[model samples]
Target: MFGPTYVFDDPMTLGPEPSSKIISHAHGITSSASKEEDASQIVIMNLAFNDGKFNGSALSVLGDYPFFQKYKEMAIVGGSGAFRLARGIVTAIIYTYNDTTQNEIIDFHVLVLHY
Candidate 1:
């Protein structure tokens, strides 16, 4: 699903205040887990920032998302616009998930360097 990601200025408050929006695309690929209950997927995500300080910039991520894991780390291989030639790591932790709605809230931490 491609959705709008709201950007918050402060992590502690995590208020309704959003400074910008990011369009995200995440494609899932079949994993090696044989059991149906143990299945997982490899995902690639591209996040394009649309406003505020990060407007026009984009970053790419590739990683494994285990069904039961609460925290995941992905590699940031590249980016565009203000983040051109970026490289770094992105850490994501699951905040809340809903099985019936198939919606989830994740907290992300990124450390990047660009030229």
Candidate 2:
């Protein structure tokens, strides 16, 4: 089971968006041997637009990669709520990796089209 997580950052310094916070939850299903393996994985995530704009969820199919590669991209097939009928592309970049703790800090960029 995946627990709730909070992302706290200063978006003014982040350079991408003007939002201050992004609260989200995600659960992943891995068919590959390991996350570091060059195989595909599935992830379901719910993102909260804390600015009171809207909230949405996404189902993404992620691609494989080498450990040295810090970036990855996924396809969002569909979503709900503010993202109803949403389809988009999502990009993820590894910001920090802790080999000892097997933890990593990643940055995600999402571009969506919806009605």
Candidate 3:
């Protein structure tokens, strides 16, 4: 799936800002017959930021549980532009989950230390 990402001036206040936008695309293979089943998935995602920053990663999700006791961390193995040579971590938190719709909202926090 693909969508637009917004930035907020004051995240605590839910303020809005035109900071930058992102286009993301993910390709994956699912082991479950349907989303309602307990399964595992291997996915690769590519992110392109409007400010000329880009990053991509390959991640695996092994459990059907929607809530995590620990934040999931993925490697920022490659990137471009301001994030060139980026090597850091991307932490994921499940912000929301709807069992009826089988929809999940995840928040990602990226920390990059690059040259």
Candidate 4:
């Protein structure tokens, strides 16, 4: 679960490399994860957004870098606050276990809007 409670320390990284975005919230208050067993597995359960401006830039803090480009063109509906912001927000709970010694993992992004 990703929330305002899971705070990650500075110099964030899986091991020696620098992580793109480290957890920056306190635990058990907003979101919770089981990192004691398999630290690599990240579970983002919910994403909450406060009511305010609706600019595209406001969605930047929703998650980390390399967000899905397709989400920008999508739309969110329903009364639930979660869905209200989900339309423009792109949230992905990724679980990656890369062999750092063999290949360097790379995130690819492509933006396409057919309107």
Candidate 5:
């Protein structure tokens, strides 16, 4: 599925817990991979910040995320507002997941450079 077979708008927080500080929101689309290669998922994401200095800025991230791994790194392609011309790497880690609800909590460590 090249289109948004899996569309999501998940909260961006400082920590992995639900009670973590909400700093932004991540709106993204992930392609549904074939059963044999489902371990690594492709994602295109945009993080829209709404708090503090980063308010109104957005970051575009794209990469292949291997969920089973301890950490997955994604590229910070570009951005708007404060993060304009941004380019960097974001390390993602799965914090928690609920099988019944299909809910997941991920932690991201972003190292970026911008104009």
Candidate 6:
């Protein structure tokens, strides 16, 4: 199944200055994973937005890359004290392929929101 774009109950826009956010990798690494699942691929990009009237924004792309707004999902990591959102226009792509050693690798980013 395809993933949702900008996973949140709030609305979003791709405009100038763009809402700023804090992004982090789940593995704490700024690198990419080199594993593919059953010929199926999963790629995620984490964008954070925090400022103005906006609480925050989160975007996730799975299965494929060059994801459109309709294919992204709003990521909610923690709640309340950790409540946050992700925001950002991703012009990047998600790619997955097997290596010679054959390892199931996965890569994604986590956008941390803050006021």
Model 6, TM vs. native: 0.23
Q: For model 2, what is the alpha-carbon lDDT of residue 83?
A: 73
Query: lDDT per residue, candidate 3, 13-88, as tens digits?
Result: 1111223343343332323222433332322343344322343332222222223344666566666565566677
What would you estimate as the lDDT of candidate 6? 0.32
Pick by TM-score: 1 or 2, better one? 1
- lDDT string for model 4 (9-112, tens) is 22222233454543222111113333343222222222222323411111112233322222222122221322333234333332333566532332222122
Instruction: Give the clashing residue pairs of candidate 4, or none.
Output: 5-25, 5-26, 6-25, 6-26, 7-25, 7-26, 8-23
lDDT on C-alpha atoms for all candidate structures: 0.62, 0.52, 0.43, 0.27, 0.86, 0.32
For candidate 2, give the lDDT of residue 45: 43
Model 6: residues >4 Å from true position, as ranges?
1-13, 16-30, 37-50, 55-74, 79-115
Candidates 1 and 5, the one with greater TM-score = 5
Assess the local accuracy of residue 27 in candidate 3 as a C-alpha lDDT between 0 and 100: 31
If ranked by lDDT, best first, what sequence of candidates would result?
A: 5, 1, 2, 3, 6, 4
Model 6 C-alpha lDDT per residue in residues 23-81, reported as the tens digit of each score: 32221112222243422224443333344443343334333332222233333333322
Query: All predictions: root-mean-square deviation over Cα?
Result: 7.3, 6.6, 9.1, 11.4, 2.2, 12.0
- Specify the highest-lDDT model's number: 5
Cα lDDT, model 5, residue 65? 81
Candidate number with the higher lDDT (1 or 3): 1
Residue 71 displacement in candidate 5 (angstroms): 1.2
In model 3, what lDDT does residue 48 have? 40
Q: Which should have the higher lDDT, number 2 or number 4?
A: 2
- Whichever of 2 and 6 has more lDDT, that candidate is 2
**What pairs collide in candidate 5?**
none
Indicate whether candidate 5 or candidate 6 has the larger lDDT. 5
